[model samples]
Target: MLLLIAFEAAKSGLWPAISSALFGQRWGDNVVKGSVSALKNGPLCVLLNFPNLALPLMFVGIAAMRRLLGGPLAWAVGLMTAMYFLFAVRYSVSDQFMFFVPFYAMAAILAGLGFVRLSEAGKRRWLGVAAIILLAATPVTYSLLPSITQRFNIAVPGRTDLAYRDSPRYWLVPWKNNEDSAGMFARTAMEQVPPGSIVILDSTTFYAVDMIRRLEFSDKDVRLVILGKDSKMDAIPVGTPNVYLDSAGEGYHEKWMDEFATYDRPAGKALFLVVWKGR
Candidate 1:
């Protein structure tokens, strides 16, 4: 039943999402363009974009080692890792990579199983092998340093570079990416906008906005209209109060901006809050 609902939503939602010029055309264009790029660059290129090249091999190694040395539990972890790759390879969008969390968990399970087996194999003599693997893998994490990591694109030669070459963040320290800023923006929106106003936003900004509401921001009275997915300005009921909150970016809605009144101008290139005229 749930699958049926999900399928129906996809079928019905494509056009509405596309007409909004956010998800529909953008997604299709990306898939089409990425498909061509992937083919030209070959398998490694595609894998690099999705799992950063080393990860898929690590996943495969874990699965294979588990199958040879461990029992059913370890084997299952391997199988799950393989399964995730099967799906991920087909729809490997970087932004949508969060869907592969289960795959990562399974890979971790396999790694843990390997460590246990290594400990047992040589009666504690082979324990150092596991420690060595850990040491080798530690640097890969640093390879994700946004500065150097961002430049490590194997698909494009000369673009590849060491992960720590120019990175400022110290190795292995958790870096600030999304959590703090998203929360701040959500709070700002709730505090500035009146209750019960319609807050229209693009798909990306909508997630943070909705997340803040769901978590403790607590301004539940407002309605969120995800632009490019929901109806445009004409759909709002007469006399209804409405606000449009969009993050500043390539897809700035000029028509909406020209029509609406700027309610609150927040600092940074992250987001903007606007309201419909006379509301």
Candidate 2:
């Protein structure tokens, strides 16, 4: 906790903003209110997300009661797993899939402990070995096999369509899925902007393109500005070269299209760029 506070302080001196954002300010943003309806299916989500480890985790409960892996460690793992599971279930974030990462890690630890207990079964050692093989091979069969077959040009059933690549349903299934092409489109769009030109990104496009720019085009000379809904035209400098990248539908670009001499170009799927010729 102290290290985290020190790191945050060193990175940004605005402690109040940081605290507010973490505590409440940003909590309601992008939350899926209907998540309450899906609470009953939380266990199903866990099983589907962590297919390889779901069965093994059953042993964690047994270990916790029998103290197979020591009382403290077993109880600690079980308690942490339960806490994280509940948190993931209750958190109403739209991108709730990412929040399961810590839960997965803790569950993996408990699964490992379960495997250890199973392996020590004297007469049913074969059961332990079989469990280990299934646990290891489940991922290979479901995730890697599809990827490998596709790489070698081998035809396989249930291999077509990557639309779910970005969805949580395929989080553990495919090895290298390309369902979400937004990143590729974002990169292509960003490359068209000339060096030293200002790039304005709306709320939706800011996160999508900013990450790609930092990772792939960090050396490109461009000033990036985030244009929020309440931002004024004065936020942009007058008589300067600027490119506006945003979603195709009604947005800042559409609202101000009549105000400026603009050239619209389709950058990629559901994304477009507007070259602003200052009025």
lDDT of 1 by residue, 173-253 (tens): 235453254466666776666677767676545787788877865646877777765535566643455454554333544
Candidate 2 TM-score, true structure as reference = 0.54
Candidate 2 lDDT score relative to the true structure:
0.55
Q: Highest TM-score, which number?
A: 2
TM-score, per-candidate, Cα-based = 0.47, 0.54
**Regions more than 4 Å wrong, model 1:** 1-80, 109-179, 192-197, 207-223, 228-230, 236-242, 248-270, 273-279
Worst 10 residues of 1 by lDDT: 158-167
Tens-place lDDT per residue, model 2, 186-211, is 67656767787666666545677788
lDDT values for all models: 0.50, 0.55
Please identify model 2 stretches exceeding 4 Å from their true place: 1-45, 59-66, 69-75, 116-124, 141-183, 194-198, 202-221, 227-243, 248-270, 274-279
Superposition error at 179 for model 1 (Å): 4.5
- Which residue pairs come into collision in candidate 2? none
